[model samples]
Target: MVLHVFHGAGYERERVYAARVMFEEFLGLEIALHAGQEAGWRIVRGEEEDGKELRLADVLFRTPQGEWLTEKAMPSRPVPRWHTGGHPVKAPLVAPDVPVLYGEEVPNGGYLAVWDGGLQIGADLLGGAFWMLTRYEEIVRKERDVRGRYPAFASLAVQEHFYERPVVNEYLEILWWALRALWPDLERKKRRFTPRLSHDVDWPLMGAGRPFFQTVKRAAGDALRRRSAQAAVRRLGGWWRAAAHGDYDGDPYNTFDHLMEWSEQQGLRSAFYLIADHSGAGEVDGDYSLEEPWVRRLMRRIKERGHEIGLHPSYETYRDPRRLRREFDRLRLVCAEEGIEQERWGGRQHFLRWEAPGTWQAWEEAGLDYDSTLSFAERPGFRCGVCYEYPVFNLLTGEELKLRERPLIVMEQTVLHRQYLGLDPWEAWVLIDRLRTRCRLFDGEFSMLWHNSQLVDQGETDLYRRLVETM
Candidate 1:
């Protein structure tokens, strides 16, 4: 099916990109945007060969294009007013009470009117989608945490407290419902809910990666603070074995076996993003070398077990294209030596530190196929307001790149860490289940990050098991 999208002037490139995201990318249908016409007109869907047609007239939705002006782009103090809450949509796949964003609300109950002659839509689905997908807010807003990363609290999604909802998906569903209403026989691209598991190898071998003083300090804490002699001994033993015998697997964070075994049990392959450079990786970011025998052994095991090894750029590489390229090359060179012939290369940014199209551009220029680094570190919901993997477009360059974004939905730390969502195992389960259910509702892919070092704690290990089993 070919959808002829008629629209008025202003933001032609933006409109084209957003329409592609809405129709071609999200809905999996062919579309053509016809400009120079009154946008408050009709959308015509037809068969190219037979010339059969259907039309939805009177488009009442209009994007506040003026808001894009540099000075006025930022959301106001009362952000929730600009966001739709419990908005009703007619998509058969999702709940009737769904959330939306950035679009003006009409008096009608539904998000947009599915009329035969009148305005079929009054919500700016394309505009809202474009705003969220391109992360327009992040670029306009400069507020950052101490780590120089965008703070989750400042995001429009969190400001409106809809961080847990994939509003972009809801927007697409509204558009799909409108199309299906006009042509009942319209079939969307079939999709299945997929669980994409990944591990960021920040501390693959906890004993070997830290400074001696730091390790000793932590050992002291294990004994004095926790009052556990056995724990202290075990920590010291891990350090000794790794240092004296190169037995890095003896370290508490060397839980690669457990990860591979669990994924195998689930008939899944987990992606392990390895840190390839250390130029800007502070002590806290891990100091393990990819050239180490232990890391090489681990990589070999991962490949032998049919898992994936990807690049995890160092802490400060996100903003530096030269550093990014050097790190990527180092990883590929090591992979080639180990006979790990991966057709595609991709990974996450350390600390999830990214700077919009710049980081994305660096990845694309460095020959990476995808980047799963779009999640907020302090919050683990839809930072990009999406759960699906879609090709990204540079809002600055106004050109689509080859890199696709696999938006991270859940990071173990985001839920388990005391500083973030701060949920217990049960609470974490509830929150994760809600996120996963949302993905299933839209047949979207769910990507999760669970650091190997986190599993050293038995309680965290058990929680990890439950997450994998449930997925």
Candidate 2:
């Protein structure tokens, strides 16, 4: 069935495009874009006519009579409602009279609701979804961290107290309910949400790849910085084991084999992103070389065991297509040498350093299948307003890129380390469980990242183990 959308001249093409994506790609429905008026299941930007229609104009669409299309609407704000089963939600799209058990409301706008036999939504859901999906706020907001990334605190969701919510998915749910009421015969596909586990081999082995002097310097620095003799002694022991046995498997940072074993025991697979090249200056990448014998052996082992090996593009490659291509080429060469032939590849950027459209364009140019780097470094939540993997769009040009994005939901360090949230193990576990429950609600993929070096901490390792087991 083709759902006809009647967009007026005041409607932006990008908004219409986003709505089309939501309806066709996400909702599995056919859309027929039309101008002016049309027949059967029509969506318009003005007050309802004498016939069947739905209104999604409000903030985005204007009437031909030179008047605003909706009621005196205000900018969306968090509406701390008792519904959503403890999940955060923006303003609701249904009326209070409809008896919606799960929804929110704005001040004067009431709830975003459907009228005229479910033919209309009173709010600008398409606009809201478009804004969230394209990260429209981030594009317009001029906030950046030291690494040129948008911090979580700067986000509209965070500022509005809904960063923990997947608002786009909630919008989709509103759409789903409307569509079901409109067309009862529509067959919607049931989605099964699953956990996507990935590891960034930032420091494959803490002591294995570093030069002897560098290792000694790190040990001494630890002693001086923390003023702890025990830490100094522990670092020395780790270095000795790494140097003598050529295998630091017993060391906390060298947890590759353990990771594989744990995954195997859980009957799951994970992606391992290995850094191929280090940056020249003013940037830090992993110390290990992709061509190192031990690294090669590990790569081969990961692939042999049915896990994925992907390129962890260096920090400098985030905006440079040429640099990204070169790094990916090196990774491909090494994988070929290891006799691993993967048809499609995906990865994340080092330090999560990315520059929106530029980084996305670079990933497409480098021929990556998907990228899982759209999350906050300082915090963990729905970075793109949705938990499902979706094709990325260049919000600037309104062009859809070839690359799909599996947005990272959480990173171990984001919640655990003192540099970030500094949550205790139990607190971190509770947060993860909450996020996972949200993912399940939408039947969306929950992507997680754990640095190989972090596994050295028993608390982190146990948390990871619990995470996998619970999933």
TM-score of each: 0.89, 0.86
| TM-score quality measure for candidate 2 | 0.86
Q: Number of clashing pairs, model 2? A: 6
Runs with alpha carbons beyond 4 Å of true place in candidate 2: 10-13, 37-53, 61-109, 112-116, 226-231
Score residue 210 of candidate 1 by CA lDDT.
Answer: 56
Candidate 2 per-residue lDDT, tens place, 295-391, comes to 8888988988999998799888887899999999999988888899997799999989987778888898889999999889888898788888888
Candidate 1: TM-score?
0.89
Candidate 1 lDDT (Cα, 0 to 1): 0.78
Which of the numbered candidates is closest to the native, going by highest lDDT? 1
lDDT tens digits, residues 1-471, model 1?
Answer: 677777777677777787787788777898777886673434676645333333332221243565562436553444323222353445644344444444344456444543443334555667667778888877878888888888998787887777888888877776777667566788888888999999999878656555678788878987898776766776788888877886767788889998999999999899999998886556756878888876898899999999999999998887899999999999999989999988878899998889877999999999999999988888778988888998898888888888999999988998988778788888888888889898888889899999988886677788889989988
- Displacement of the residue 82 alpha carbon in candidate 2, Å: 12
